[model samples]
Target chain A: MSEGLTFHFNVDGEDFTSAGQASVMMKKNLRQLGLPPEIIRRVSVAMYEGEINMVIHAGGGVADVNVTENYVEIILTDSGPGIKDIEQAMQEGFSTATDSIRSLGFGAGMGLPNMKRYSDYMHIDSEVGKGTTITMRVNIN
Target chain B: MTVKELAETDIFSPVTLPCGGREISGVYIGDLLSWVMGRASSGQAWITIMSNVNILAVASLADTSCIILAEGVTLEQEIIDTAREKEINILKSEKSIYDIAVFLSKII
Candidate 1:
């Protein structure tokens, strides 16, 4: 437990019903590691938002969580349509999700904002035609 | 108040009580899953009109006492099965979110 632990998950984009499965499993892993509840909640929320975004916008992706003594880092990589404007996407209510996605109780444009709010640090890398990757970290302290 | 007591009320009808016997400390009303995830606290009942399966994720993450599907929203079979498997309580209510919230405030 001194060095760090990394967990990887494949997010299924086809089934909207199973979108948050990765985040749920991540929460359980964090609990087993004896991380603080606050840290676990923050990481879980941030990762869950990213996972949902990947499903709704990016059509699924890969999630990697790195747990260390100081912080937990979540990396989401998707191969779907990438974001055109990172700044605008970071806004609380700006979204490009379809009407159907909104009907599912998501696509409120709060996903990225919530991720940033809960995490200690966040970074977004995207190419409009290529894909998007989001990295968020939460401090253990 | 315990979840059993709330379920007995006229407004709330328990669908599955995987973990409904626990005490409820408060109420949070919201439809947005991420918003509810960020705001709802542990031991609270979440009232929402959304009947998607993701609500179970939010409830489990937030550790809500039970989820009340307000406005007579019927949950899909997938959601009900998942809730049972996950051991989370799912309830149904014919009342609106506003009315459910009011009743919850008065009681719990």
Candidate 2:
């Protein structure tokens, strides 16, 4: 088998109904690649959270996943309004999502925290007006 | 018990058979998708009142046995069609989340 595989997706920010589609596909790809269940779950959860965040805060974005021998890497990029405070955003209960978003059962302020919780490594790069790009990795071991 | 048996019970009404014959392992009740995503285990039935398409995402990622829409929550046809397409089992119930949990506890 190859040492690595990459998958790219264009997330549509206009439709909330279609969020997480990328993560679902990624899960299937990981399963087909014969990854361990635990590793697959972690990668899926982290990627799913990032996908949701992209839709909720960034008005959609791009997701790229690279799977290698020892780890799975997820990179999400969005051009929506950038985060004003990354520190506050990382808190478990601090969300900037509106009430409408909350009614959809998201905006719990848990997305970033949960992503970090599931992934072995995570990094966030953002500017106030430009956009944000998050990178997360889950180790196979 | 299998999901088929649970759906056959008076408490549950089968909406989609994607998990018709799958075995039931346990139950987790919550409306918060993130919480459910983090806590739900494979083969367990997830109970929630939120009927949006996001439920499908959580159910698929968690690999749940079935999703029970408690309190007579009706879902849109699009959601149902998606569930069918995704091969996700969905059940509807007129009972409260608490009642459904109690019933599931007794059975599985």
Candidate 3:
């Protein structure tokens, strides 16, 4: 397979239990494509963190993954309450998630940081009233 | 210690898989995400009551051997299925996360 691969999914925020389905499926699909384990792990982890953020922070979102020879690009866009402070949101141990979300073991405030840590590149665009869109890329090399 | 030993020590019985049990290793227990992210090693079994899919995501990033969900917690099927597909072993027990962590630390 010399061509690039692309995959897309609609992340449902209604059910917190099913939040990471898209990332999980993508991880499996990338592994089946025979990508390196490191690459697959990075892509999945980055995408998974992004997916969780979308669920916990935004109501729902759309994720598009473009896999090419050089790198894998993940674009996650959400239509929910936007981030008021990206800097604070990126800080470790700083979370605005409700107690209910914390009980589920998330909302540790590690979502955005984790995404940035695992991805080769990351970009965030958001407004207070508008929704947020995050672009993250993990290199295949 | 192996997960089987964890099962025996704790009253809770977790579903078992044979991917990473052959390699017995240490255990890490913490709810603090930052510490775990930077310090948790590969091949060490992570014991946490945290049941979010992010747990699986963190485990993947840390390259952990498996994740043990304690305190009689029931993980969402998405988490179980995701961990399974990722080849990450997931176990659930009746023991609290604290109790299992202490027990596993002494054994390993």
Candidate 4:
């Protein structure tokens, strides 16, 4: 537990229903590691929002979680359509998701905002037509 | 009151009550998954019109007592099965969102 314990998953881009499985499993893992409840909730919620965003916007991506003594880090990388404007995407109630995505109770433009809300630090890097990478960390203290 | 007791009141019908013993202290209502995830307390009953599997993730993440699907929103069989396996409690109500919230306010 002194060094970083890493976990990785390939988020399936095809199925909408299968999304968030990675985040759910990571919650269990964090529980077994005996992290604080609030910390676990923050990491789970942040990772879950990121996972959902990947499913809805990107074609799917990779989620890597690194747990260490100081903090838990979540990295999401997607190859689907890249976000054209990070500023607009981060605004609440603003979304590029279609009507169908909204019908599913997602795409409220809360995904990235929620991720940022729950995490201690967040960074996003994206190039339109290239890909997007999101990094978030929740401090243990 | 526990979730089991709330389901027994008959206003909220049980879809599956795998973790019915969780205590209910308050109520929080919302449909947006992310909104509910951050705002819903750990021990409140979450009322929503959304009937997707993602609700399960939100309930578990927020650690809510149970999910009350307002407006008589029913869940699919597969989702119900998943709820059971995941040990999440779920209930449905024929009442509208507001009426259900009022009822919950009085009872819980």
lDDT digits (tens) for residues A1-141 of candidate 3 = 347788999999887767777977897788888999778777777787788788888888999999988899999998898999899988988999899887766777887888888889999999888899999989887
Task: Encode model 4's per-residue lDDT on B18-94: one tens digit a residue.
Answer: 88888997999999888898788889999999998989999988889999999979899999999999999998889
Q: Which regions in candidate 4 have their CA more than 4 angstroms from the true location?
A: none
Candidate 4 global TM-score: 0.97
Candidate 1 docking class: medium
Q: What is the interface RMSD of each candidate, in Å?
A: 1.0, 0.7, 3.6, 1.0
Query: Can you tell me the CAPRI class of model 4?
Result: medium
* Pairs in steric clash, model 3: none
Q: What is the C-alpha local distance difference test score of candidate 1? A: 0.89
Candidate that beats the other on TM-score, 1 or 4, i.e. the better one: 4
Which has the better lDDT: candidate 1, or candidate 3? 1
The TM-score of candidate 3 is 0.79
lDDT tens digits by residue: candidate 3, B1-108: 665555555454655454745354678887654346545666777877676666766676666777777777677776677777766777777777777777776777
* Candidate 2 Cα misplacement greater than 4 A, ranges: A1-3
lDDT of 1 at B88: 89
Superposed Cα RMSD, model 1? 1.4
Q: What is the lDDT of residue A108 in candidate 3?
A: 78
Cα lDDT tens digits, model 1, B12-107, are: 889889775799989888998878988888888898988878899988887789998899999878779889998989889988888888888888
Give the DockQ ranking, best first.
2, 1, 4, 3
Candidate 1 lDDT, A82-141, residue by residue in tens: 988899999988988888888878888889999999999999999988999899999997
Winner of 3 and 4 under lDDT = 4
| Over 4 Å off, model 3 | A1-3, B1-13, B18-25, B32-42, B51-63, B71-99, B102-107
Error of 1 at B4 (Å): 2.3
In model 1, how many backbone clashes occur?
Answer: 0
Q: lDDT of each prediction vs. the true structure? A: 0.89, 0.91, 0.77, 0.91
